[model samples]
Target: MPDPILPLQADQIGKTYRQGATTIHALRHVSLTVEQGEFVAVMGASGSGKSTLLHAIAGLIDVDAGRVVIAGQDLSLLTDRALTKFRRSRLGIVFQSHNLLPSLSAEDNIRLPAESTENLDQEIDDLLDRLRLSARRNHKPAALSGGEQQRVAIARALICNPAILLADEPTGSLDSVTGAEVCRHLRELVDDQQRSIVMVTHEPHVAMWADRVVVLKDGNNLAEFVTDGRRDPQSLAKEYHQTLEGEVVR
Candidate 1:
């Protein structure tokens, strides 16, 4: 049998920006692949290109070089309109801020991506139940807790049934306890639902929940390691620090 196609494959992705006289290389030949049902965390310090890589893979911004293939479709080849449609159907994104509309209820928020609400009612209902937001489905963003809001955001992202979920600082806004709750939800999405996730996070505790951690430094791939949920957050943090220190020494 042929090798299975990955849910996400970013190859030699490079992006640069010019600010006055200086050139900022936000990403440099950064390549990553995420398998189906796998949770991969991209961990980096500020300006380490972690978010840039996520944007590149999601086609939120154009990369100066390299290509991002999602489910065998090359993102760079699509027209802007086509890309937007493709993204709506194929990609799910969650951000640090819950990004929920205050005016809409949680169920309405999750139904935003569907073209027709009539057809998606059952799907949305099932998704809300799965996300454990059934009771809070009618609540507005202001009425929900931080964790609930984020869970609603996740439900919204998943309502489309996208091939992979791209999360940027997904647990950044929550307290430690709430953040852990959100992380466990994401892990369940991978292990139970066979969903793939590529999350960009600076928190070691959050990254520890992933199947593997990919570290970025100075706009390049620094190192990667499998976590297997065996190691503690402190050990992961120490390893991440050592990886950066080693890169600096070299």
Candidate 2:
């Protein structure tokens, strides 16, 4: 048999931004691979280029060097229109903000990206139920609580049935309790549904939910460690700091 296609493959990706006379490198020779049904978290400080890498994988920004291949298709080989269509079909993205339309109800927001109506109702109902928002389906975003709104956003992201889900600081706006709840739901998706996910977060508490964590610093992948299904937040936090400070941690 041929080699299995991964959910995500980013190879030697480089990104640079030019501001007049200054050029800032956001990513330098960065590479990441996420297997099917794996949950990976990318952790970094504000300027560490973690977000840039995520966006590059989502095809929101072009990388100056290297290639991003999702499933088996290379993003660099697609035209702009093809990229947009492919992204909509193959990638699910969730940001820090819920980004739901205030006027639309929860179910409607989830239905926005849907391309076909065949079994659409059943699919939307299933998503709402899976996210535990079945009761809030008719409610608009303004009426939902922070966690609820975020769940709706997640439901929206999954509506497309994409190959990979990319989340950026998914819990940044919620309280600790609510954040933990969202993280639990994410873990459930991986364990129960075999979803492929790549989450970017700065908090160890959130990163601890993933199967493995990749730490980034100064636009490069600093270190990576497996949670091994048992690493606690406190210990992971310590390991994260040690990795950031250029210390070895096993």
| Cα error of candidate 2 at position 159, Å | 0.9
lDDT per residue (tens digit) for residues 1-250 in model 2: 9999999999999999999999999999999999999999999999999999999999999999999999999999999999999998889999999999999999999999988899999999998888899999999999999999999988888988999999999999999999998998999999999999999999999999999999988799888999988548999998889988889654
The most accurate candidate by lDDT is 2
| TM-score computed on alpha carbons, candidate 1 | 0.96
Worst 10 residues of 1 by lDDT: 241-250
Which predicted model would earn the best TM-score?
Answer: 2
Task: Provide the TM-score for each candidate, comma-separated.
Answer: 0.96, 0.98
lDDT of 1: 0.92
- Tell me the RMSD of model 1 versus the true structure: 1.9
Which tens-of-lDDT digit does each residue in 72-187 have in candidate 1? Answer: 99999999999999999999999999899999999999988876566598998888888899999999999999999999999988887899999999989899999999999999
lDDT of 2: 0.93
Q: Identify the runs in model 2 with alpha carbons over 4 angstroms from their true place.
A: none
Report how far off residue 79 is in candidate 1 (Å).
0.4
